[model samples]
Target: MAVTLKAEKREDLNKSVTKQIRESGYVPSVVYGKDKESKTISVNSIELVKTVRDEGINAIMSLDIEGEQPVNVMLYDYQKDPLRDELLHADFYMVNMAEEMDVEVPLHLEGEAQGAKDGGVLQQPLYQLQVRSKPADIPEAITVDVTKLEIGDTITVADLPEAAEYEFLDTEDTTIATVVPPDTVSETDEASDEDAEPELVGADGKDEE
Candidate 1:
């Protein structure tokens, strides 16, 4: 289900107006979609943060703009204050529920790999996956089980189970996770050994240059 978020139309585009909006605990935002005119708006900063925290980023939203009908939307992008770590602005993309769209979904590994338990290193090359699905059918995340993975074993996109709701857009050979033998020597250790000064010794057991 889509979460409903109330928003107010923004009229003033001046810097002062934007500063005031931020000071008032609201985030300046814009809503746009294909064939639809873009609208400038603002939403309560606290409410927006809470919604995203509770619902995953891929969660669909019902944007209730004042004086207009609600529209199905998704949070496309956002900006934040680098120093203050505060939300500065946001962008909402109005979505057509019936049309399929491509989105990146987070990938999660489930369970401990047998290879890792045996002292092998487990590596995840791809942490997210490109998926195509309708707005309502979009998944929160794609999970892969690695419990059975042994050393040198890899899980690729093709190994994933087929799903009717969404399709993976990545190439079949794209590796998601893998296990490999642990390195005997780290790069730092190797560099240190190479840079070490050699000890001098004589045939008679006396130190000599």
Candidate 2:
């Protein structure tokens, strides 16, 4: 869900002044991105938190700043007050809805794995992969079926049900998740001896314990 916010100008950029601003119940934030200059504005802390908590990190927000046209942006990062547990600051990234957006969507696996019932371990190597699509076409998450996965059966990135219009940012050969025997040997052996071991141990003797 997209959100909208109204911001006010702040003349003070000093720490002491910004601290005073926070104490009064306002959150100072900035919107940063590729082409546009960074702009600083203050918003209602309670309202800002409510919008973010209700929506999501990827939610596009229409920011209404004085003397400037309303700009739509996505929340990229934020800083919080650990002690007070309050919103300290936030950063919004400018999003171009018309262009393809690369995002990582959540992964949800359904049903009990047949292999898992017979002492097979279901390992989800990668829960999410970076995908490219327009904002309106963005999917909340990808669903994977584990019901038919039997021992020794492997699932690769290509097995995922990808929308025709979207492009997966990951390589086609990338492994997503898999169900295998409890022994955990075939994949482990191939990954370790052939490719993974050398990369995992650059010089350190960090073999499997």
Candidate 3:
């Protein structure tokens, strides 16, 4: 599904100009492509948030710039205020639907890890995977099943479900999720004495007598 947004060209290119635009409830943005000339634009803050919430960043967008024809684009990047969660700026990458592109798709874990039930710790070391596929064919997310995972077991990139349309960009050995024993003090920790002096060696390569 295509997410569409309405925007108007922004002529002023200054910090004060962008600040004023935000005060007026708009997000300053830039759209650029391999062949298309870069253009400065702005979109209504409320509408932009709604579009992102519904379609996500991977979805193809139909940017309807005022006084120009609509163009296809992808949400490349954006910034937000850390304290207030206000949208600051955005950059849209124009793309050709037929061309393949590399992107990171979120990994969604499903089911409970058997290790967790046995008092083991379940860890998700990686939250997303990089994949190459056509912009239009990009998936919303890749789901992983963890019901069979046991303690000390791990799921690697190579274990992911086969997707003929996607080429995973990560090394096959990279672990996405794993289960391990709960943290506990080791024997070495219990035996160590903080007051014990460290061993010293003589300059002649022998232990001190």
* Residue pairs whose backbone atoms clash in candidate 3: none
- TM-score for candidate 2, residues paired by index: 0.74
Instruction: List residue ranges in candidate 3 displaced over 4 A.
Output: 184-209
**Stretch of 10 with least lDDT, candidate 1:** 200-209
Predicted candidate 3 versus true structure: per-residue lDDT over 91-136, tens digit per residue: 9999998899999998888999999899877788899899999988
- The local lDDT score (0 to 100) that residue 137 gets in candidate 3 is 86
User: What tens digits encode model 1's per-residue C-alpha lDDT throughout 1-209?
Assistant: 89999999999999999999999999999999999999999999998999888887888999999999999999999988766778899999999999999999999999999999999888898999999999999989899999999999999999999999999999999999998887732654688899999876763432110
Question: Global CA lDDT of candidate 1, please?
Answer: 0.92
Can you tell me which runs of candidate 2 are displaced by over 4 Å? 81-86, 185-209
TM-score of 1: 0.87
What candidate 1 gets wrong by more than 4 Å, as runs, is 184-209
Each candidate's TM vs. the true structure? 0.87, 0.74, 0.85
Name the weakest run of 10 consecutive residues (lDDT summed) in model 2: 200-209
